[model samples]
Target: MSMQTSIALGKQYLLDTYAQVPVVFAGGEGMYLIDEEGKKYLDFVGGIAVNALGYHDAGLSAAIAEVVEKGLLHCSNLYYNTQAIAAAKGLCTLAGMDRVFFCNSGAEANEAALKLARKFGHKSNPARTDIISMVHSFHGRTYGAITATGQDKYHVNFDPLPQGFSYAKFNNLESVKALVNEKTCAIIVEPIQGEGGIVPATVEFLQGLRELCDQKDILLIYDEVQCGMGRSGKPFAYQVYGVKPDILTTAKALAGGIPAGAMLTCEKANEIFKPGDHASTFGGNALAMAGVNEMVRRLNDPEFTDAVQQMGSYLREKLVQLAALYPTLCGEVRGMGLINGMVLTVSPRKVVDACFERGLLVASAGYDVLRFVPPLIVRQQDIDKALAIVEQALASLL
Candidate 1:
């Protein structure tokens, strides 16, 4: 089918929610996506950092296929399943959390975390119901998740958002301190603000929050939906700073592109829910758990995670070199592991469009930042090729 025809069909049937580009991807091979016209484009976006194992991972594919052949895709939450139990154990062990509640998306994972915190707060005292999130943070698009988002632009036209949620400046302890009170139930933050221009929190800032939460008896939640699952050179982004959270949420690459998410809670916060508290019908199905099992096994490997750090360093060095070459356009390079962004003087949308036209797939974050979140399995040669395309696209702007 023609790309235009596909786009027109989408416009006719789908909700007018996303500002989609005109491209009909037919298939993906490793790090490249083939369009309907048989043109190959290097996939740096990795489905917005969801494809952790790259395209057509042999082990992951085999596991999913085996589950399919077994004719046990989903058996409902009525009975126990081995896949969910194993997946939960693996994730909890890696996160150092006591238990997990599975869901279908990052937004759902965050929503669960929010509800868990509220329940925990009320259990302690009926008046503790407020939550403090950080400014410029991007939680999901659901009602609760959107309200938790700190950006006002998302809150537009969606007034009457869930109340008792407030915002504070990221990486600033004083801002968080000013917002905390006896009624505050929890503070949710992204260790690395993925959508907020790839800003990372300082070690001291995270440590201070831990201390404050401990002193005030407030729950500290880390929304690692975009930065977790080995993307930050570790099992969880909180591990990068040697700070843990009372509740941790993760998705995106949690199941190697499968639709799955999880909210993990430490021992103190694990008992907030009972059997009838919350549930998801399609959460932790056999198919998703199969993918999660294989993906976690690979992600848990030391060599695979080390490669992510090494590749990220190489990519950062190349970005720095590009910044030196075009000091007028490139302002700053920030991020850890495989998630990085280049601050630009020009419009990021124009650069992203240019790269797309040149057979490179990248994304724009915030207003003036071009983000690169290549698959964790991306190699040195892929980085070189991507850098070349980025250089060409960036030079065109000048």
Candidate 2:
């Protein structure tokens, strides 16, 4: 009947993978979630950057309602649905790509990208199936994604991972260049490294990769799982870098809060996946598309995206000022658009716990950086309210 009772039941059923907080949400409205006791918390973390439009948005709610009213949830990937088709079209058109493949999550999308790359290369050389991923990049927890992800924390326990995966240094073009050879199928990167401490790829580095990929005749993949769909104040972070990838994977904010993932690629690369090369039983279903379409439409609007850009700047400025107040504990802030990080000179988990206690939600990246990937719909004042809590939390750290 109570939140604690419900959480206890959940732990018994769910895997003990996540170190969850003690609060539970009964319902949520724009950037705020109410616990069963009716206590409200400012949701700056935005469901770990998945709620691009925040919780229970009217547009998203209406879309889901309308679709459910039509008696279609799991339409499968057999009969085509307009909702999915429209979403795929809108996504490709916005990203300047030719085709789109829908899945379920960011990790799934990245997994799809990996398969696409391998298949494309295997078709051409059959031997050149190797991939080069950057160190510290968080692709996903799936077998292929985990293999591609360069972090040891996720790699430990999952031994004998898929071969043909190697790591290079982040933001260092030379590191990537040194790894590329005849067997390299593609080089995957996140334009702005989201889970890797909110580090943005240098413009020169991205451009250099583009050129290198072109010269080597290898596919270039951009994993915009955390930095896409107006989160970066741009449709995609690749736009900011002026570099285009042969394959682009997106997911986190695709359906606002709904589970959806997409892999977009240019025309030449799109042919790699044949009729039965890949398929997800639940991919591109009508219900999921309803949510994805609404989110994409709303976020693609200039007014909404412009607001995200403006608010991101506003939030970053406040963080910079706050960081100045705590020189010893807080380091410089980094990142682009709303997906910024507060570089902490101390432990990130302590600050995160402190924020949670103060009725604010924040997430940590790597180990020492605090990330803020709030909903694009969040206003400047709500950000200020969240920042106030952040300031207080840092002050208490002293």
Q: Can you give the TM-score per candidate against the true fold?
A: 0.99, 0.98
Q: Could you give candidate 2's per-residue lDDT for residues 1-398 as a string of tens digits?
A: 98899899889998998898877788898889889889999988888788888887888889999988988787777789889889988888888899999999989999899999999899879999999999999899999999899899998987989999999998899999999999999999999888889999999999999999999889999999999988888888888778899999999888887898999999668889988889998889888889888977886688988898899899989999998989999998988888999889889999999999999989899888999988888898898899999889988989
Question: Per-residue lDDT for 1-398 in model 1, tens only?
Answer: 68889879989999998898889888988999898889999999999989988898899999899889989999988877889999999989988899999989999999999999999999989899999999999999999999999999999999889989999999999999999999999999999999989999999999999999999999999999999999998878899899999999999999998999999999778899999899999888989999889978997799999999999999999999998999889989999999999999999888889999999999999998999999899999999999999999989988
* Collision pairs in model 1: none
**What is each predicted model's overall lDDT from 0 to 1?**
0.93, 0.89
The clash count for each model shown is 0, 0
Cα error, candidate 1, residue 357 (Å): 1.0
Q: Evaluated with lDDT, which candidate comes out highest?
A: 1
Candidate maximizing TM-score: 1
**Distance from true position, residue 99, model 2, in Å?**
0.4
**Where in model 2 is the C-alpha error above 4 Å?**
none
- The TM-score of candidate 1 is 0.99
